[model samples]
Target chain A: MTDVEPLAVTPALEAHALSLVREGSRVLDDVSFTVAPGEIYALLGGNGAGKSTTLLTFLGFLSPSGGSVQVNGREVGADVAAARGAIAYLPEAATLYGHLDAYENLAYFLDLAGRRVDRAALEAALDQVALPPEARGRRMQTYSKGMRQKTAIALALLRDTPILLLDEPTSGLDPVAIDEFHAMVKALAAAGRTVLMVTHDVYGACQVADRVGLLRGGRLVGSFEAGPQGRIDTETVHAAFAARGAS
Target chain B: MSLVFRIAREEWRLWSRSRVVVIAALTIAVLVGVTSLLTARGVADQAANRTARQAEAEAAFFAQPDRHPHRMVHYGHYAFRTPPPLAVFDPGVDAVTGQSIFLEGHRQNTAMFADARSGADLGGFAALTPASLYQLLVPLLLIVLGHGIVLRERESGTLAVHLAQGQSGLTLMLGKALALAGVGGLLLLPVAALALAAIAGGEAPLAAVLLVGGYALYLAVWALFVLAVSLWLDRRSVALGMLVFAWLVTSLVVPRIAIDAASAAVEAPGKIESDLAMLSRQRAIGDGHNAADPAFEALRKQVLDQYGKQDVAQLPINWRGVVADYSEKKLTALMNEIAEDRMTREAAQSRVVTAFGIVSPALALGAASRALAGTDLATHHRFLRESEVLRYDFVQALNNLHARALTYADDAARSSDPEAEARTRVSAKAWSLLASFRFVPDPASARAARAVQPLGLLVFWLAVLCCAVVVGARRLRP
Candidate 1:
């Protein structure tokens, strides 16, 4: 008998014709996308473009009014705990417990996600996010925005979840920190993690994402992908984003 | 459950670092401790003072000189009401209801030495006992400290992260409530110690236990109420405003209005009114004091017939003493009927107040606390009734001596002639034959039984608030 090739692997995340209505207003309309294992997909748009709303839908925070969202080939609404268990979310301007130091915040959140990581693993994750070693033991209230973001990102990294959903992940980061974050995201993808990030920064999304979907007025208006150079064209996506703004 | 506990620990850690929370907790602990000590001292002092006065009155009664029995009837004894041991915690209604009543031959006297002269308006929380702090200020402290437990999470976006970490809404709600309840339990510690001390001091053990339990449940109810309000509201400021308004209405406004409404709804006749009614009834029975009244004339004829003598002088018993004894029995019977009617009206008024407890947990908790401590209106009425019974018994015994100890001729002439008056006097040792007045307090079991209805009302409040929490939990979201 001829050897049979393995069937195509199921996508780690899928949003098919996802439509959401919130407070009597349509926030998402007919959005469809797929994030395979080891892929980073970014939904790029301006404010009110439903980018964050899409990420929330996949995390089971918001139920779509029409169609559906799935995590690892299973409907999100069918098993919310399992859906959440598989994903680590970093929200826009992520704020951790101000009363707790960076290390404590990391441990607390990691414990909450049902992970029993040791201090060494936590430090390693913090080191990966390039958080200042001196600031790890001080209360986060005294921490700068970039420091807090780094702590939150380190927490997401320590969760070791198969899927990561991030919204405006680098909103307050310095340029160097933003570049480092991009490299970290790339490394996590190489380790076979599926990431679905939503942002308004076109150049940043192009720098890190394997595929970029441009959104406007709650709809996916255009799409782009990396060329043979192994990076998406920033200028082309920027032109599309600006054109949509003008229209 | 472990997850809930973990979340609770985190919440404790967060609040423990908050200076405002720590200060508020310390303030409540100090207040409870001080209030408990001072009130315990006050209750002990009052109880000792009443017991001493009662003994002094008894000694004076026994030290009387030989005299006519009727004169002894007018010189009545005083019965003092010693407060129950549990009153240290509650002292409820005691300041308003007075502690001593005078017992005499032909009248029912109201209790005396009340702090407030009139009306049943709860005395405006004038008594600052440990129970009052538990009922009033602790709940306010709880609201001040915990109204932001859930709303703060939402406002800071930590709620979204928590949910994303796979924490269920129910778990979060319950966990935060457990943390708040722990704070409430901390406030109750000093009060519990005092209650335990009362029990150890040979007080009503059941009542002391119930008092502690009632206050604990009350605090728990407040915790649930604070949590439900926090979960239902979307903003911290709004939750705080709503919760404070709720506390003011339930703890302060509603209870006072309920008491005033009860007093107004069921109007108990005043002492003057009851006394006048009794006087009119006495008149209908003919003046027992007037030996020649038609009512006693029949009694005189009956005595002659019983002795088979045409004249009272031939009878073995002194005729004038017979008249005094006969009239007194009739008067005592008439007074008792009138007194019973007045007591019934007062009891009805109390029932109205108890029914109003369903509307306010503060009223419910107060009723439970008072009933358990034996300082309620029911307990005071029991004291009055018992004293009246003793009054009737002792007065009748003196009248019996008047019939048997004196000669008819001497009793008749004693008022006009000095020699006959001297002869009519009985031995001073006769006073020793009479029993001393001792107020038998309601049994611990009975006092505990009276608290059941109010305790049930408190439970009902808890149940209703629990339902609200469940609904709020279901609707909780990031």
Candidate 2:
């Protein structure tokens, strides 16, 4: 039998020289990248490196001063609602209503996104994120940072959109919780979900991401991709990241 | 459900859970109920008292013994200003202006026995009426509860999430505003019930309905105002400060400023000045009591010529009664001229004050409320004018009796001879012939019409805010 090749697929997310000017300062300058369908791409940068700003542009929260960003082949600015409909966004240290329980917050956001989930399904998503069963019903204000992060992650998962944009996804989590979160993200990608996460942790990015893009001064400085071995080298990516930061 | 409904439901949920919001809403509701009951009772008592006193005064006047017609003219009747059925909701100028006027011949008495003169101190607070609660306190409560409806979403960073969830800023703002309008609707329940009661109690249905509708619109103005301010300002605290400041200016400060401004601009004569002016004008017509006064010499000559007699005693009718009848016509005309001038100036002052409603919506709402309640200055002026008409008609009827009923010989000699005095008096049965005064209120349609301009101004305010909301919603972003 003759083997057939796969058709070329559109990128799930794209930024063509995306530049953002806010209140007279360039936040993202000539930044460019693309995440293929179902690929897990991580953007690594230090503080004020415009990583979160990049995520916001994908969510259509900020308009680019130059160039453009697209989600699912539609320009974000042209069809913001359409773009937002295709993606689930988890902001850095996402805050759900402090007065509501985890289940209530999940229900509210899912409803906002025009999705309905049964109680069992809600519990399954929470369980997948390793949130404690006892804590799911308590107000988020009573939650610790890790618990809150898990609930927010569960909310994003329940959104069930094809594209995911996570900002500082594993922030304030324990080492064990971080590893669990990374595994969950990989599982989602394996299920053909597009994942774009921005973070400062090089090793964490190298561990779960199919490719790592290094960003500095609001520009994409370098990129690392996993070879046939299916994993990128952490040492190489770290050295390159550190070198860019020092420069 | 739709996006707006979802957002509104969420907002409603949050507010329901908040202790401060729940407590404040409950407190205002309670105040509404309490104030309505108290004001209703007060209005009923006042109406009953005036009605009873009016009947008693009329009965006593007709119970007098046989007397001269001029004596019956001096023993004039009392006209009590009956409270409109809706006065319980908005007392308007009733407290400041007199509720009763004493009517007599050859004299134009001012209205007397104002409620304010009876001295019930409200501790410097606005009189606690259902209208005041709806106009002033409800809006303040809405501000306290909802100033942070949109601000909280932004501050908590949920606004970005909401947008990313495919909800536009417009929907988000509209949803929150919808929730606030729902609260305002809840606050309107007591006022609606009060208005309905007024209508059921035989008040003008159109006016009562208009009163309720005006309040709903007024509260909506406040709701839109709160939402617009919340959406426009960035910081929650600053938004709150701005909202409270706006409340102070529109609700309290602007109303007083408008009054002061109107008073200054129109320069209405005070009661003392008007009375003295009326008295001074009256003196020029001569003492109506003295038949031989020089001012009436021409009048005396005219009457004698008309009768074809050289002397008053030779005439068929009593000359003194003729002089009294003729002088009264001149005097009433003079009094009316001055009173009309004063009313014209007062109406102008009212127009100036109401015109300021364009700047402050509270003034607009207030003028509309009072106009609909039939408690405004225009209605009071109607009472004054109608009462004067009754006075003139009744006094002339008695003057007619004076001319034809008694002989000239008896009238001229009555001061010296007791037998002549007895003969000068006609039967007390003549007093029964005079028509009794009953104050006729303006038609319900007219009262409703008076409210149209101010109501239109309220609608203008609401339209401007709605436009602002549209602009605000369009400009909204996280």
Candidate 3:
């Protein structure tokens, strides 16, 4: 038999090397990135490295000073709402209303997004994120950082969009929870969804990400791909990030 | 729109799940309910008390020992202001205006027994009526409940997530507004129901509906303002602080300042000036005693000419009737002119104060509610005018009775001779013929006139807020 044709992965999102300016200051300088279908792209950066700004630009939270961002092949600024519907964002710290339980928070978000999932479907989505069924009924005020993060993941899951943008998703979780979160991200990518994560957790990123990029002073300085036989070590990626800083 | 309702429902569920929101809502409902009940009972009791006193005063007037008609005119009658049924809801400025005036023959009396101010030395807190609660306290609670609608989401970074989930800023703002407006509707329900019940029971005017509508629109404006501020501000704390300041300025500070300015701009003639002017004018016109007084002498010549027998007797018509009619006409003219001037000044003041309703809708609503209740300055002026007319009627009726029942010679001699005084007294049955004072309010006509201005102002603000919501929605997007 003829060799099977390799599946061509299409980009779920693309940004045409954009710059975002705010109040006469360029926060994002010629940043370019893309997430292909079924790929995990880890955007690594330190404080003020413009990683958050770049994600916001892609999410249509800010207008680019120049160039453009696209989701599902549509320009972000031109049709922001339509573009945004194709992606889900879990911001840093992901504060849910303390007065609402996990299920209630999820329902509010779903309803706001014009989605009407039944209770069973909502519960199944929470179960997908490994959130305890019992904890879903408790107020978010009683939740730990890991539990809140899981609820955020549940919210992102319920949207069922093709792309996900998570900002420092593992920043405040314990080591075990961080590992579990990386597993969840890997599972999402394995299911043919594009996932972009902004983080300084190089080891965690190396564990889950197929490709890693270093962001420094509003520009990406290095890019690397993990080999299928063995994962790239965290120290090598960290050294590259540090070198970009030194430069 | 359906998505907005779904979000609103979810918000309501979340709000109900919060103990603080529930407690705050309960507190407002209870306060308004209790205040309304107390006001209704107070108004009913006051009306009963005034009715009893009016009966007693009428009885005492007719119970007097045998006396000349002129003596009865000087004795005068007391008219008590009847409170309107819906005054229980707002009682707007009712306590500031007097409730009773002593109407007499030759002069008009200023109303008495009104307390100019209510509440404590701080002066900001007025009486805790339904109107005050709706105007000041309910809006404060609304601001507290609504000021964090968007800001909280933004602060927690959920706003970006929400935006990413296909929620437009307009939809989000509408949802929050609906949620808070639901609470507002709840707060208004009991009072509105009470007002409706009062109307059904025929104790209140139909204009109570206009009052309720005014209040609803006012509260809605507050809710919209709070939500707009929430969408514009970046932090919950900033939104909350700004809304509280706006409430204070619009509801509390601006009304007091406007009233004071209006009062200063149109100075009302004081009671002493009016009383002195009436007394001096009466004395100058002779009290029909001084033959040298030109007005009285001219009146006497007319009476004599009409009689044609001139020595004050031998004519069929009583000279006493002619003199009484002339004196009554002169006094009525003077009082009417002064009353008209005072009313014009008060109207000017009211116009000035109402013009500021644009700055504070609370004032507009308050003024409109008071007018609908028949407890406003217009009502007070009505009472004074009606009382003056009734006084004129009563005194002139007694004068005509004197001309017919008693001889002119007996009337002229009765003051000096005790026996003639006994003969000069008319039968007490005549007093029963006198008309009792009744305040007939055309509520529909009055409400139609008063509602237009306040409703216009409310609509203007609504338009402004619609524009604000549009701007806020644009700003709220990620």
DockQ of every candidate: 0.74, 0.73, 0.70
Model 3 docking grade: medium
- Model 2: residues with Cα > 4 Å off, grouped in runs: A1-6, A227-229, B112-125
The segments of candidate 1 whose C-alpha lies over 4 angstroms from its true place after superposition are: A1-6, B112-124, B310-314
Model 2 chain B: lowest-lDDT 10 consecutive positions? B116-125
Residue lDDT tens for model 3, B1-478: 7887886886787778767888988898889889888878887887888889899998898787766677788888898877766777867656666577787777777742112422210111357777778877998888867888778778777777778787778887888888888888888786688678668756544577777777888888888888888887778887888888888898878877876777788876766677678778876655543333566776667667876766667756567666676677787888788778877777677777777789988877767777776667777778888888888888888878767878877766777988777889877667764587788655656755876797788778878987998888976754
**Weakest lDDT window of 10 consecutive positions for candidate 2 chain A:** A238-247
**Which residue pairs show collisions in model 3?**
none
Candidate 2, residues A1-247: lDDT per residue as tens digits? 8798988789999999999998998889999999998899999989988999999888878889999999988999999889999999988878889888999999988988999999999999999999999998898989998998898899889989999999999999999999999999999999999999999998999999999998898888989999888899999999998887722
Q: Which run of 10 residues does model 1 chain A get worst, by summed lDDT?
A: A238-247
lDDT of 2 by residue, B1-478 (tens): 3878878888888888889988998899889888889988888888888888988997898899899999888998887887777888888777666678888898777652222211111111257788878878898898988888878878887877787788777778788878988898888888778888877888877888888888998898889988888888898899899989998888777777766676677666666777788788777787878877898889888888898989888988878888788889999998888778777767776777678788777778888887788778787788888888888888888888888888888988899999999998888888876576666556678877888888888889889888888887775666
For A43-114, candidate 1 gives per-residue lDDT tens digits of 999989999889888878889999989999999999999999999999888988999998888888777788
Across B1-478, the per-residue lDDT of candidate 1 in tens digits comes to 8778888888899889999988988888888889888998888888888878888888889899999887888898887877777778877777777788877777778852212322333422777778888888899889988899888888988888888898788888888988988887778788778778878876777778788888888888889889988888889999999999998988788866776676677666667777788788787666545666776777788888898999888889987667777777778888777767666766676666666668777777887888888778788778888888888888888888988998888887887999999998999888765676666558888988888887898899899989998887766667
Alpha-carbon shift of residue B2 in model 3 (angstroms): 3.2
